[model samples]
Target: MSCSIKPVYGAQHPPLQVMPKGKEERSKTSNKRDAFQDFENNTSDAWDDGDDDLLVMANIQMSLRDVRSTAQAVMENHSKQLSAQNQQTSSVKDELRKLSWSGIPKPVRATAWKILSGYLPASLDRREPTLQRKRHEYFGFIEQYYDTRHQEIHQDTFRQQHLGLGTILKDIPRMTSLAHLFQQKVVQEIFERILYIWAIRHPASGYVQGINDLVTPFFVVFLSEFIDNDVESENFDLCQLPQETLNIIEADSFWCTSRLLDGIQDNYTFAQPGIQMKVNALKELIKRIDVPLYKHLEEHCVEFLQFSFRWMNNILMREIPLRCTIRLWDTYQAEQNGFADFHLYVCAAFLVRFTQDVLREQDFQGILMFLQNLPTHHWQNEEIGELLAEAYKLKFMFADAPNHLSKKK
Candidate 1:
C-alpha cells in the first residue's frame, strides 16, 4: 500500500491532511519543496526587474515635501505640552525649596546655594563675575581636558565589563571626569547611581557615554532647585529633598532625550543600511528636483550620507560651542518632534550653501571632510536659519511625491 506524510505550518490538521504512511509522505514532501522553489524564483524575478524604482522614488519625494506641514504639527504638539507656563515664577520657587545645599561639596554647595536663594548679585567683579561664569568654567574645564581623555580610557574598561554578551555595549566611558569633589569615588558613585536610575528609566535607550555629559547639567540644575525644598518655608530648616527628584530626572531624561534623539538617532544605527536609505532618498530627491547640483556632487562623490550622520547624531552639539549648543538645545526642546524635519532641512541647507566650493573640490574625501568641518559659523548664522526655513517650506509643499509605491508588482 502507498503511504505519505506532509508538514503543516501549525496546529490541528484537516481530514484531507491524513495520508498513507509511506509513498504518500514522500510525494507530499516533494510537492512542498517545489512550491517553495517556485516562490523563491518569482520573488527573485520581481526584485531583478527595475520597474519598481521610479514609484519608490516618487513616494520618498512626496513624504519629504510633506515635512513642512509635519513640522508644524510637531511644533503645535510641544506647545500644548508646556504645562507650567502660568506658574513659571512659583515653579522656580518650588524647585529651590527642595535642594539641600550643604550636602554637596563646599564650593559647589556654596555657589549653588546662592543661586538657589535668588541672592545672586546683579553686578559682577572678576573675582565674582557671575554665577553663570563659574558654572561655565567648571563644566568647560571638565569637558576639554577630562571628558576628552576619559573617553579614551573608559572605552576599554567598558568593553571588558560588557563584552562577550549579546547585550554587551562597546561604547561607554572608562572613567567619568566629574568636577571638584564630585570627582571623588563616593560622589561619583552617587552620580553613577543617578545615571543607573536614568538608564532603567529609559529602558528603550539605556545609558550611553555622552548621556552622562548631557545629564550632568540637569543634575546640577535640579540640585540647586531642590535645596530650598529641603528647608522649611517658615524657619528654613535643612533636610533631604524628596526622593522624587531622582525619579523626576529619570522620567524627564527619557522624555527630553527622546525628543532630542528623534532627528539624530538615525545616524548611529543607520550608519550603513539606514543612513544609506536617507542619503539615497535625498539623492533621488535632488536628482529629480535639483539636477545640476546633483550632477556636481556625484562628480565629486559627496554623497549626503558622508556628512549627515555626524550632523544628525550629535545634533550639531559637539561640533559647535557650548553656548550655541545650549541655545540650539533650547529651540530643539521647544519645537519637539518637528526638530527632525528642521534637522533634515538644516542638512540640505548646508549642502546647498556649500555647493560652490564643494563642487570645486576634486576628491570625494576632501569634499566629505569639507562638509564635516562646514562652518559652525554657518550653523550659528541667521542666514542659515533662513535657509532652513526655506528648505522646510519647499519640503512641506512637495514632499509626498516619493512616499507611496510598491517595489514589487
Candidate 2:
C-alpha cells in the first residue's frame, strides 16, 4: 500500500478546443456579436453597477458548474472502479480506500459506503440478491423481537425495566434536531425501530447514550438515495416516499450501523473498557506528538477523560458538524478497523488542530469549555479533508511503533 495521501483540492481539467466554423456559422456569430455590442452600448452607462453584478453572478455560476462537473466526474470514476470485474479484489479495495481517504463524492457515497463497510458484496450480479436477503433477514428480526419490547417478561433483571426504548426515544428527538429530515415523525419512527432493534439484538452493550448519534450518518446517507434534494438543507415529506423505500433505508441503516459498531463494540461494553483504553491511548499519542501540550495539560491537572470521554464515546460526533462527520466516515469506512484504530489518530489530529487555543487558555475550565464547544459550524469537506490527511500522516508515522503509545516508565 502506498503511504502517500492525496490532497482533496486541485483537480486539473482539459482546456476547451476551438473548432473551425463554416461561413454560415461565422455570419451568425458576427451578427450576434454585433447585436450584443449594440445592446451593451445602449445600456452601458445606465447599468454599470448591474453589469458588475451580472459579471459576478456569471462567475459564481461558472464556479458552481465546474464544481458540479468535477463531482460528476469523480462519481463516474468511482462507479466504473466499483463495477469492474475484480471489484471484490484487494487491489480494488485498496484503490477505493485510497480514493475514499480523500473523500467520496456524494452521488456515489451510499454505494461506496455500503461496499466499504463490507455490507454489500463487490459482485454486481450478487448485490441485489444480497440486499434482498439482508433486508429480509433484518425485517425478520424486527418481527421476531421488535414487539417484545413491551413485554414485562423481556425486562432487564438488574434495571427492572424494559429494553432501551426509553433511552432510544429520548435520544431520537435530541439527535440531529437541526436537520429537518430527522425532525419528521416518520423519520423518528424509523430511527426508533433501527436503534431499538439493534439494541435488542446486541445484548452486551445494549444502547449506550452516544450510540444514538452514530445512527444519523448511516440513516442520512442511505436516505439521500431516494431524495432528489440535499437531505440536510431541504425539507421533504417522508409521506411522499413509499413505505418499501423507507423499509430499505431503515434496514440498510441498521446493517451499516451494525457493521460500524462491530469494530468498536467494546467501546460500549461493560465498564466501557474499550473507550477507557482508547482515551488513554489518545493521551499517550498526544504526549508523544505534542509534548508541550501534554505537559501543559498535565501541569494544569486536566484529565483526559474530562472532555475526551465524549469524543471517544461519541466518536467525535458531538464535536464536529454532521456533514463533516459524514465526510470523515467516508474514509473511516474505507480503512481497516477505522472506527476503533484510525479514529484514535483522528481524535489526536482534531485536538492538535486546536493547539494554539488550547495552549492560550490559562485555566483548565476555559480550555475544557473551549474544547467542548469548538467553532466547527462553518466547516465543510475541505476542512474535513485536511483533518483526515493529518490523521493519515499521524498513522503512517506512529502506527507500527509499539512504544508510540506506551506509558513512560
Predicted model with the maximum TM-score: 2
Native-vs-model 1 lDDT? Answer: 0.46
Model 1, TM vs. native: 0.42
lDDT of 1 by residue, 63-177 (tens): 6658988898998887866544436644553444333311333234433334333334312342255434544443454345334534655445445433211221222232222
Clashing pairs in 2: none
In candidate 1, what residue range of length 10 has the lowest lDDT sum?
Answer: 163-172
Per candidate, the number of residue pairs that clash is 43, 0
> Tens digits of per-residue lDDT for model 2 on 16-130?
3345678547646664445444445554554554454544444344578899998999999988986675644667678788888778988899998998888987667889999
Which segments of model 1 are wrong by more than 4 Å? 1-255, 258-276, 288-290, 334-336, 377-384, 400-409
Off by over 4 Å in 2: 1-88, 156-163, 177-179, 230-234
lDDT of 2: 0.82
